[model samples]
Target: MNIIPILASAGITGFESPAAEYSQLGCNLDELLIEHPSATFIGKACGDSMQGVGIFDGDLLIVDRHVTPTHQDVIVANFNGEFVCKLLDIKRRLLLSANEKIQPVVINDFDTFSIEGVVIRSIRCHRPSPLLSNK
Candidate 1:
């Protein structure tokens, strides 16, 4: 289980107004960039297999190769040379899903399975937009 620590910084408040000063806050961008390298932006999830988990179609998924896969976490993997997004169920030995309509895929043998990476974040657009337009 790979866990990343996230620190919250306090913002500076102005004397006369409620606005905060942005210049005073400092972020360790270098450390963050080093740990989270080589991010692959997978454009849109098409299938309903992950719908019960709140991951819908046309949602942008941020896949980080740096993080290790853990139980119950959603991940993108290459199963039999095909890319698939599913929940990682390393303990139960089955990739379980909240949606009963879509059957859970059991990973009976670990040797046959290889996790590409765990999903770090998901970006969803409120309005309709093209994922990538040729024009």
Candidate 2:
């Protein structure tokens, strides 16, 4: 969903070669990208506040609740009853942003905040999917 579209150019296949030994290879993406499947969930980013970190609006966020968040880790959290994505500054107890224009949010004692998960992966779509509405 950051899917870098490859510009496929036209190519020519001169002649059919003899049938050599062939094998089918299996590729499971989940095994490569996910560590904790049951504890992981995917969410879509919805704002321009984290573009500097390569997480843009409409990017698919793979958040893992089982993973412990570290300092400066990008995370999804329930901030005041709503979900938000931000950088976790544990020492300062604040939510920071990659974009300079977006101000950091301090976590006060009165605020209702809970860390939902640590953002492990994010996907961006370079082109619209055929399954989705065409623009």
Candidate 3:
């Protein structure tokens, strides 16, 4: 898909006239990957299953769908019919945990589970504290 351009409009003194200006903020996936080979754009992360791994809510995960999932690799998978992210333990047929609080989930039925992609990177934003006020 091509990059969707944003146009800026400026109002005229007498009447509001439409004006167009190209935007530089937005980018196309093809152009971005070409410029940065290590970069991969996937869907947003949900749930706290991977919080210990520094992947929190609303984080954008860069998953290389082409990459083969290995032991301990964080992967996006389709369990039954729902999508989930977890550590892959191919040998033991289990999903390991980076957090002690969360236990490893075993794959008793392989037919019900399917790996979608391997997580390559995670992106998060730092938000300013709302409670703290300036004097």
Top candidate, metric lDDT: 2
Error of 1 at 1 (Å): 33
Ranking by TM-score: 2, 1, 3
Best by TM-score: 2
Cα lDDT of model 3 by residue, 11-106, tens digit: 445643333333354566655643335644466777788888889877778777778788889998888788888999999998876677888888
Query: TM-scores across all candidates?
Result: 0.64, 0.77, 0.61
Q: Report the C-alpha lDDT of model 1 over 25-109, residue by residue, as the tens digit.
A: 3446333334475554454576778888888877767777778788888988777667778888887777766578878887766
> How accurate locally, in lDDT, is each candidate?
0.68, 0.86, 0.74
Error of 1 at 6 (Å): 20
Model 3, residue 42: C-alpha shift (Å): 1.3
**Candidate 2, overall lDDT?**
0.86
Cα lDDT tens digits for candidate 2, 1-135 = 122224333576454432333343354668757899999998889899999899998888999999999999999999999999999999999999999998999999999999999999999888876653324
Error of 3 at 131 (Å): 25
Among residues 3 or more apart in sequence or in different chains, the pairs in candidate 1 whose N, CA or C atoms overlap within 3 Å are none
Which candidate model has the greater TM-score, 1 or 2? 2
Error of 3 at 82 (Å): 1.2
